[model samples]
Target: MNVAFDKPSPWQRIQPVFQGFDLPLVFIVAFLCGLGLVNMYSVGFDNGSRFFDQARNMLLAAGVLFLVAQVPPQRLMALAVPVYTVGVLLLVATALFGLTKKGATRWLNLGLVIQPSEVMKIAAPLMLAWWFQRREGQLRPLDFAVACGLLLVPVALVLKQPDLGTSLLVLSSGLYVIFFAGLNWRLILPVLLAGAIGITLIVSYQGDLCQPGVKWVGLHDYQKNRVCTLLDPTTDPLGKGFHIIQGMIAIGSGGVTGKGFMQGTQTHLEFIPERTTDFVFAAYSEEHGLVGNLLLMAGFLALIFRGLVIAAQAPTLFSRLLAGSLSLSFFTYAFVNMGMVSGILPVVGVPLPFISYGGTAMVTLGLALGMLMSIAKSRGLMQR
Candidate 1:
């Protein structure tokens, strides 16, 4: 009575794969990718390669999402420590003896130029989720301290590399996990208050701090310039502030219904800097207008909502924590990128998630979506 089963037919094998996938999330991601393609084509008219590379990145990301979706949450948990350890060690290696370019040492050379900081974006949250999962019932203050230590090491290293953007991203990802794990409100409020106070101080002292040759404490000269320029872009109108000024002008010119498609004069006239990358949003807003912006926001909110639903349905603490953190981190990525492009926040080189033309960020987002799909898939497997 122990006869071996035969292989499933091609259709039979393919049917379950599609059925197991999270269709709503799939639709949301597809819509965003399609929007990205349109925007890339429109903004990258001067150089079509960005449009092509963005397409390639989307394909690579899809493959990653599909493959990762096949794995169960429990199995993914097993990878937490190993992946995090490797990612951090690589970061340390990057800090000690790594490649330097453009006055920043964030890259590594292993026969190829690679950025190690990018990997921590996912690894930090995964590792923290696993740690919290293990100490679910017996969590203590010291556990939070250890968790903070785990989160800070790579963040500190990335800071040493002086990559404010990636470090902030990584830090936010880890903090999402920490926040989701029942962290006390008392501990969170002080940080928020301090941040508010710091912003106020910076704005008030803008005139004094922004003077030429005045260096900021614990921040690079260029970094301080960015903050000061954000306070008042007219301070360096044609130089450091050009990008922000041009971006805001482009955004404001869009009006209610935008300039329509490729008719954005600012984009075509080359006023917006890095139209295909960090400042792509301005180009998008200039073309798509308010209605288009609302649609895009809706798409992101839909995706985030689905992610939170998946987190709620997750079967384990680790899965729940990871899913929630990934979801919020996705939100943070979009918020900061859009805020930066709109001249409301300092430009820290964060891409606009799926819309921005970059391989590493797309891959990271794919991995996160794949994890969400995997968690959803795990819930299905349990019900069966």
Candidate 2:
């Protein structure tokens, strides 16, 4: 007897793979990518090269998103330690012999000027989540200490590079992992109280303490200047304080309705510093006004909420921790950027997500969202 086996059709062969795709997650990412393209067009109208560069970056990010989406969460857990180790070593190397620009040595020149510290923003959380996943059944205080150590090592090094914005992001991302992994509220309360007291004292005695030659120990001069400028930009209105003052003016001038797209005088006239980067939101606000800002904020809020839902439904501890941390990290990025631009917080050079013109940050965000989609898909698989 001769038997012939039936061949599977292409759709049958790929059905399992296609079923794993998360449409909601894909929609969220595509929306952000579209917004990025729109903002890049407006910001770089005079500079065609920047517009093309942003397009290239977006394509690369889309590739990363697809590649990462294919990765299983279990595999990500296994790779976390190795990725984190390499990222830490890069940070160490950056400290020793990195390229310096504008008084900060945050990038390494290896044929390309790479900011290795950007790696830590994702790696730190991945490493921490993996650690917690390993100790899922029986966690202890020592495990938390180890996780904290994993976070602090890179954070301290990045802060020393004087890129305070990215350092804080990395630190916050790691801390979110720890928090989601059953960190005790009792332990956290004391630290929060201490932070409150410190902020109060700083604001209460700002004049006496922020004087020139007062010898603030840890903070760099530029960092200190940012804090002082936030408190009172009038002190150096035309000097070091110009950025904050101009940003605030642009934001306020928008009133209830924006100046219309490409009609922003502050942005086109070059009144705003870093219009395509850290202060992109201010430029956006100038053009779109209050209604535009509200729309932008709503989109961010929806994205964060969707991410949280994905985290809650994640199949494993690693997925949950990574998804939760990444979501909160996104929130921190928006908060810091908007806060600084609105003159409510210090200018720490944090980029506005999906709005700012930067390649590294765009790639980082793509990787993060991809991980979330991976987790979400895994959760659906487990449910089925």
Candidate 3:
């Protein structure tokens, strides 16, 4: 029997790693990644090693995705509470003794710089999903209230870090989980109505409110400036408004069919600020135009739609809630990034997913995608 034994091929050895993968999700992500690489090369070739660095980041993210996808949803539930606890602790530590940059203390140094808020992006949803799962059928309003308390603690910590973008992402991720766990719409609609009224009031009284030293009570000085700038960028055409004005110029110049690929003068000539990072969508628009924007949006919609489908088909309550929240978080990221670039929303530090060059955000995105895939795979296995 020991005479002639043949070893399995390399493909066979690694096959189990991808045994129950979701094809549509894989294809959609691959399409977006291809677009990202092309855009990076075109927009970042002159920005030193940005193009290469981004490629490396994407590769690292891919490795993270594969590793995370292999973890079953049950295992993920087991890790949620601990991950959430650690993330909140890190945020607290950051507030007490963190590295400050540009007037915000958002990063921690534990041999390496890390943003604890990014961890909450996934951990918040995971923790919430796991919470509801424990109370599966015997859910009470008190259960929902307790879940809100768990979510608000981390959210408040991140906000105190004054990292508004990361805080919003964390808040929304947890809210999505709560909503999925069946919080009453009666509670949600009133908040939405109040927000609408607040926005209307802000716009109507912008002139009086935005005057120098008026001092909005809750917001920081810079935060007030961002909102005021968004209301009417022309008020500070050269100083605070430069980013928005330049971004609008680049986007509008793209026209119907765009300036064509690497031929974008606004992008190539360096008119768009942060062309390789936060304002990447502006650079992309300058090169690809409206047609490109539509296609890009279509890709995002496909990703969101597919993710929701997986959530609906998820075999467990935890999987369902986690998948749904992560799916909508993608919407929040894309909507806020694009809205800011297009001059419709206040500019914060949110990045255009797959299109922007951020190692941390890319890894966070990979983890979210991996969770989606894990849930999808679990659903398939259950059916089988």
Q: How accurate is candidate 2 locally (lDDT)?
A: 0.89
**Superior candidate under TM-score, 1 versus 2:** 1
Native RMSD of candidate 3 (Å): 1.6
Q: How many steric clashes between backbone atoms does each model show? A: 0, 0, 0
Q: 39-68 in candidate 1: lDDT tens per residue?
A: 999999999798899999999999999999
Which regions of candidate 2 deviate over 4 angstroms? 1-16
Off by over 4 Å in 3: 1-9
**Least lDDT summed over 10 consecutive residues: which range in candidate 2?**
28-37
Question: Which candidate leads in TM-score?
Answer: 3
Give candidate 1 regions above 4 Å deviation. 1-8
Per-candidate TM-score against the hidden true structure: 0.96, 0.96, 0.97
Error of 2 at 370 (Å): 1.3
Mind giving the per-residue lDDT tens digits that candidate 3 earns over 107-197?
Answer: 9999999999999999999999999999999999999999999999998998888988888899999999999999999999999999999
